[model samples]
Target: MMKFKFFLLQALLSSSLACAGVMGDKPETETPNRLFFAGLGGSYNSVKLDQYFNPLIGTTNIYNGGTLVAFGTANGPAVPFHTTQTTFAPEAQLGYLQSFSNQDWLWGIKLAYNYLSITMTDSDLVSPQLGTLTAVTGAGTGFTGRATISSIQTRIEHEFDLMGIIQHSFKNIHAYLGLGPTTFGTRTNIYNVTGFADIDGTHVDVSGTPVNFASTKWVWGGVVELGMTYFFNPTWFLDINYRYALSPHNKTNYTSAFAGTLANGYTKSGTLFGTTNQYITVQGLTFTINKVFDFV
Candidate 1:
């Protein structure tokens, strides 16, 4: 009876050792196989501007032997213009990721593109005799103008997995932060004039010749992004991101025929021509869906 008990104990010990060896020899589990991801998303942007309006001259209005005019108190009828605009922006991205044992932890690099358009218009009408436009030695006058600008940008991003939560039977969710540099290009067009001047029931045509102006500028800056992503499976996910620029926005200078010749000529004549610097800064939020195609 004693021998039989000892033999049973030895067989159980042998079985345990064999099971441990098999487990130790097995390779680590492979990560998800999806690696390449492409997505399209829309973004909303907040753009702010600093604008400069140079001295403008009208053919029919003369003051002090110069077509250019400035009104003190009683500068008769003048129009005021204000504009508001909204844009629909689109984005696309591609990236590669590495995952650790914790599926929530990841590191990756992304390249993205964005396209946006911005438009603005000015509209206001007041009698030239009001306190605003009293200088013209007559009853006051009324005008309208519009301008549009568009741009496309490409950015390279580097991401760090910040934190996440996962359930045994549910999709994985992760939050991350990214930062990188961006390159952008823009085109601007202006379509505007001081409008027709109506003096005491007589319509004076004061439309300056239409001007065509354009410029291209390159901008470089740092960008910061915060995002949340959910994995439908190990290979597919959706992400929502918000990005902010860390550097100053830069724009190309545009020269108008009137501004260059007339304004410069005034300066040469020892008169003051008002010119202000105008620029816009970009800030945005985006949402996208990404699929990872990992081969390793």
Candidate 2:
């Protein structure tokens, strides 16, 4: 009986040791692998006029009934016609990200869309007449024009944490910096009068010669962004970011009839045409909510 009791004690000690060894060899549970996110935000935009000019002349002689009027040097007033514009824009982004480790370092790529609208107003414009009047008339001869710009941007971004988190309750909050190139396309529309008014304030309808312009071209530029994100959950977070264009430079040329009626009873008309090679910088603050899809 003493030998049997000794054997039983030996068996229990071996079993316990085997169990502890198995437990030790088993791997520790890993952090969940979450990786993709989508977000929406709004931004404020400021657009300014870079350059504009218009010039007109009569290509044909004027014949008022049996009188052959000499098409002398008839010059109209030079009117400055443009206004600066500003407004708010709405934007959306979809991104795919992969985390290096639980230390809070992440690298990602994003595709985004932005919508903006700008307005140009010309007030109290003067009509070009047959006589030498070089002053803008106070009469309501002004018109408003608008331009809409949209863009599709592809970006690569990196996220960095100040204090690298290893073991902490609040370790997901961090700051990040981003930069990338953008290709944009823009559309513009202008509306104005064609033809001169008689001395009795009667408009000589010259509908045959109206001005119009349109364009959709690829514009290239770069952008830089800085922001902070708060990770409320393992796979969910919110961020507030500010972005600015590194090079807001572009050139656009357009031609349209502004004023005056043609001398051949077709009403006089002028073409305002020029290219704007100027810098357009914008500041935007946006709030974004994101969800991660882990695949690790």
Candidate 3:
């Protein structure tokens, strides 16, 4: 889905750029037409994560047979409460831009490294049962398998972008657009994981737990950006732009971690994987000061 979205976005951006190229086209050329440019900027970003759980966990449609409470409505997978921390991070970008076909028209590539993440779903959660994974249990006879998950910290990513660029220069103002592939080092963390299964009259804590767990991986995605730069002189400029980035649609199969011990003689242990697609999208506005040096 994310890939499809990116392709669609690419198509739209291409169409718009093509039309603009034809409508206000000019034969623009300059001395020392090739340049290497570098800049520092800040990107304010928002990340959104979506994952709906499998109605039935594992092979069982019923957990505790409606006798005890689960995480959701009639014993769900997890709880409703969640938290999202937003960050405004700095980005470092360096790239080469040069005129192609015309002096006013240019094509180049920009490479950037930055970090961001999306805020989780809004307040009211239709399904609080999402992200419910645990180690299976042993030792004690089961009564009602219940769990209290203190928190599931969301995902964070270090994103690298390699964008193909196109621009049109008019007087002192230059408008540009870019679209290309991206890569990420992503991490997901879960904390305070504890569960219970009522045996007889006692609620025993399900052990072999992942009290604090984290997993990391590499992912691929895409980004589309549009911006304009104001030239202070021929070699210096100030740029402000908006960028929209989409991460790949990925899967979750727990942290592959089951630690700690069970208080009850019979232990509980197992892992949970959601039955939904999880992805991230980022929208940012960046401001930068840049300098371009004439090269070959």
RMSD of candidates 1 onward, in order:
12.7, 13.8, 15.8
- Candidate rank order under lDDT: 3, 2, 1
Q: What are the lDDT figures for the candidates, one per model?
A: 0.47, 0.48, 0.61
The candidates, ranked best first by TM-score, are 3, 2, 1
Per-residue lDDT tens digits for candidate 3, residues 1-296, read 99999999999999999999887685332324688888887888765555443231321211343332232111345433323345787888898888877788889899987866433433322322222322234222223564444445455558788999998888678899999988767766655554444445665444334354455767678999999988777788888888887776755555333333345232323443333335666677888888888866
lDDT tens digits, residues 1-296, model 2? Answer: 99999999999999999999999896543323445666677666554443232333322223345343423223233244433455676777776655566545666666655565544444334445453222122222322222211211111111111111112212556566767776544444433434333423544343234444444555566767776767767677776777665236555565554444454553333343433343334456767677666665
Residue 114 Cα positional deviation in candidate 3, in Å, after optimal superposition: 2.3
- Model 3: runs farther than 4 Å from truth? 1-32, 51-76, 79-86, 115-144, 155-157, 198-204, 208-210, 255-277
> TM-score for each prediction?
0.48, 0.51, 0.64
Question: Which window of ten consecutive residues has the lowest lDDT sum in model 1?
Answer: 267-276
Candidate 1 lDDT, 46-91, residue by residue in tens: 6544333432223222344464453322122223222334455777
Better of 1 and 2 by TM-score: 2
lDDT of 1 at 250: 46
Count of backbone clashes, every candidate in sequence: 26, 14, 26
**lDDT at position 136, candidate 2:** 24
RMSD of 1: 12.7
Q: Which sections of candidate 1 miss by over 4 Å?
A: 1-34, 52-85, 100-104, 121-171, 191-212, 256-278
